[model samples]
Structure formats: C-alpha cells, structure tokens
Target: MTTPGWWAMALCEAVNDKTPLAVAFAGEELVLFRNAEGQAFALEDRCPHRRVPLALGRVVAAGLQCGYHGWTFDGASGRCTQIPNLRTNEPVPPRYAARAFPVSEGNGFVHVWLGEGVPDIDLPTDDYRPVGQQFTGSTIVNMSHEQYLAAMLDGPECLLNFAHVRMTDFFLGDVRKEHGRLVLERGAVWTTQILPSNFVVDYPLIVRTEVPVQGGSIRVDLLSEDETPLISLAIASGANRRGTTSLCWRGFVHAEVPAKAPLRWRTARVWHKAPFTVNSLIDGSAVAALLEAPSRDLHAARPPRLIPVSAVV
Candidate 1:
C-alpha cells in the first residue's frame, strides 16, 4: 500500500557499496544497495526463489548476492546475474528477475519512486539548501504516520522543540497551498519573555511548517518577527512497522541570528550545536489535547490517486 510518489527512503550515506540497507514503507520491505561503481538501487527485499530477504545478502562485484544461496542480482535491473550451481551453458531465466525500482539521490537523501511509470514530480528536497553545519538524526516513534502528520499541523510543539523558545497556539494565517505543499504559520516567543494575558497584536518569533500533499517530506523554519529565517529543517517521514512512524531529519541554524535571541541560543550557534530537538518520546496527553483545525483543510486539499497494482510487484 505504498503511496504513489517519490518518497525519501534514506540518507545517501546510509546506502553504500558494501552493505544492503533495509527500509519499509506502508508495510512493504525494500532493500537498498549500491553497485561497485557507487550507483544506488532499490529492490523488493524478497528473493523470488526462496523468499529470503535480499538485505540479508552481501554486495559483490556484479551486484547484491543472496546470503542463503549464491544467487546474484544486477543492481541496475534486478536481473539474476549468477547462479552458483547452474550448468555451464545454461542461461539465467529472464522471468527470474527480482523487482527493481527507480532510485535517485540528492540533498543528502535517497529517494525511491513508488508509483507507476516515470515520476513527473521534483524531488521533495529540491528547495532545501543548507548554508552551514547541519544537524541530523533518525528515529522511529510510537505513533502512526497519519497521526504524526495531523499532529504536525495541529501541534508541532509536542513533536519537536526549539531551545529557549515557546510555541503558542496562535496561528498567523489559515492553511494554504503553496508550491505543492500545505503551509501554515504560527506565533512563537522566547522562553524568557512572559506572555501577556491580554490580546497581543504581534509576536517576537514565527514558526512556519510546510507539509506535502502527497509525500511525507516536511519543512519547518524558525524565524524572526519579520520572517527572517533563523533555523531551517527538512524531515523525511513515513510508516515503519506496526503503528509506528519513521523519521529522519537534517537542519541548520541560519547565519542571520535574531538580535533578540537569548544568550543560550547565541552560544549554541557559536559552538555549532543543534538549536532544536525532534522528540522521540512524544507526550500522549498533549497530543490528545490538540484542537484539530488546519489539518481538516490539509485532508481536503490532497488529490486522491489509485496506486497501480503492478508497481508493487
């Protein structure tokens, strides 16, 4: 049940010439490996012959070789290249090929096309350009992917936190579609400042979140009151196993630090430390309390498309 789009499967550095990396999306297992020439490829984890996971195999000069039996698969096409006990003149059956997928890499992420035919869309990280040292991490959380995306729109503070900053419940604008993503803005303030009890017209900080209508690539930015970007983060999210969600993120603190930032924020930037944290332990009570608003619009904005059954094979 993979969604029809190019999903960021893993970081480019995670897949290499020596090892096969195993990842899952919507319960479908995929094995990622690189050929001897450093070309990346994705294949259905199962070997058609014995149904053993190809990820459990090893990479050879020609392609990935199954560990159970010495069967080898070509990285580019998933064609069976070698059979250990085949007769000298016998040719490998053309129908014995393992399923292969279209893979591309850029912006430090490895993307796999899960849809039918060719991908007509840009890579999710196309707009992401980091200016300095990047802080990155990966984790699997105890939440469903759909719930996680809905929480991102309703309450992002429960999923992540920026040091010395407090995210308020005030949204600056309605959720709107921009460049194929649902963009929402919220008001934020430094932890040192006390929130006024009365209605305030302005906020000292801004937090903008952009989520795709199809894929799970999300972008978050902490900015000044005037929208000067302070920190930018790109998150690749999808289903892992069971009801849990997989998350991988890379972000950088922008060079233009806000003048009103606290001393701790300044020191962290100077030491090249991560200014934000994506929570591995989400607060269940807080998520339950979130008022569903913008996510309703997000659900409406998404266009439905049927995933071709052949793509899964």
Candidate 2:
C-alpha cells in the first residue's frame, strides 16, 4: 500500500554539493547528488555490478563514478555510461541501470515520490523559509506513519481535552489558564491552525506536513506562521522492551535531561484502534471530511476558509 504525498528526503542545502549523500526512505536506500548543471538526482544507492554503494563513489562528468571499478552511471537516467574494464566495442546490457526516483526541490526541501507510475498530485510549494533556525530539532520515534498522522490531526483537540490536559501537564504547559479560540483552515495545499492566544510565547500559525516513509514510518515537517521551518522529524517503528513510547526533544527549551527518565509519560503511544476523546473526535472528523474532497477543487480557491471549533471549551 502506497501513501499519497510528496515525502521530503533532505534539506536543499544539504545536497548542494557534488558528493553523493545516502538517505533511507520507506526501507529503501537512495543516494542524492547534484550534477554538473546543479540539478539534484536520487538513485538507488547500490551499483548493479558489484553491489557496492554508489554513494561510496564520486560524481564524475558522466555521472556517479563507482570507486570500486570506475563504473559510471548517468545521474538522470541511472544508466551505466562507462565501464573502465569493458572493451572498446563491448556493448553494455540494457539491464545495467540503477533505479532512479523523481526528485523536485521546493520550499527548501528535496521531495521524492514513492508511489507507482507518474505523480498525480503536485509538489508542495509553500514558499516556506529554509530549515536550520529557531527551535530546530529532530528524533526518531517508535510509531507508524499512519499513527503519527492521526495523532497530529487530532493533536490540538487532544491537547484541549479537559481530562487528558489535566492528566498530562508535562506535555501541554498549563491548561488552567484561559485560552483563545483555535482556528482551523483546510485548503488546496495545506491544513493549518492558529495556536491558542493564551501563553507566555505562542507559535501563532502552525503548518505541519506528515510525509509517509517507505517502512511505514513518517517524516514530519513543522513550520511557523510566516512559513519558517521549525522542526524536521522522522518517526519509525522499532522494538521497545518495556513496551512503552519515547520522545527525545532537543532545543533551547528542553536541553537539560536525566539519564534514565521514564519514557511512557514523555511519549504518547499511538495505537491503530485507539479511542479518541470527545474533542479529538470532532477535530479528526472535520479533518477527514476535508481530506476526502477533490484535490483540484481545493487548489482552485484563492485562500482557505477558516473554520472555528465552536463546541471546544
């Protein structure tokens, strides 16, 4: 089963150099590099010849030159262009090609499509600022891509839930304080919300993108109101001996930590059939409705309409 969306593979600045950078997505290893023309390309990391990682090689005039035996593959088509050991008239077989993936650069991110055939949905072009500033952090989590999406979709409402908020003060600051209305907008390109007014410092507009990775994991991107990148996170499934969840936060806010902190309270476990609170149910249902609509019609509008949750207390 393939998820429908553009998954961000790496930051634009990270792949600006000629060296091939290896990245893992959806369980497959891919090497990213820039050609002589400064265009980015992603190809299967393994060379068809000796099974050596193409990333271990260097980018040459023909494309990525394997360091093992001077085998060169085209960056765009992943076709084997040269083999130093081959005779002058020896014809290379058509099968000698590295699998290539479609890559596009936008919003300071290099995105790749993992689904089959041509991409029907357009790449995200939010004009967001490049990452690497202001509260930027990332950590791998033990959860599936679908679980993370459902959790984030209902996150605001879950945070606002009276019982859950009271029980978990560690996650949400202080719920006793009165908060303003939470506004949600669903549109052609994105779904966003305005954080509650009350707080010492509030990140007003929260723009989030949940991208599905190959191995059922997820890569989440969080942006601020002005579309400034905040956090780039990758959540993947793994074994937990204690049967609990974990969260590793790194930033100015939560720098200090303990050696053996309890992971259960820190991380919220996302289950497939987990029960939702009243507030979250409402929020998740609305989000589902918006997602079910036609994508073309959603993109045709100038700006998305903001719908406030009236029933939330």
- Winner by TM-score: 1
Q: Residue by residue across 169-196, what tens digits does model 2's lDDT show?
A: 1122211111111112211111122233
Give the alpha-carbon lDDT of every model: 0.84, 0.45
RMSD of 1: 2.2
List the pairs of residues colliding in candidate 2: 26-214, 26-215
Off by over 4 Å in 1: 1-3, 195-201, 303-308
> Per-residue lDDT of 17-105 in model 1, one digit per residue for the tens?
99899988645578999987788999889998899999999999988899999799987788998999999799999878788888888
Estimate candidate 1's alpha-carbon lDDT, on a 0 to 1 scale: 0.84
Candidate 2 matches the true fold with a TM-score of: 0.50
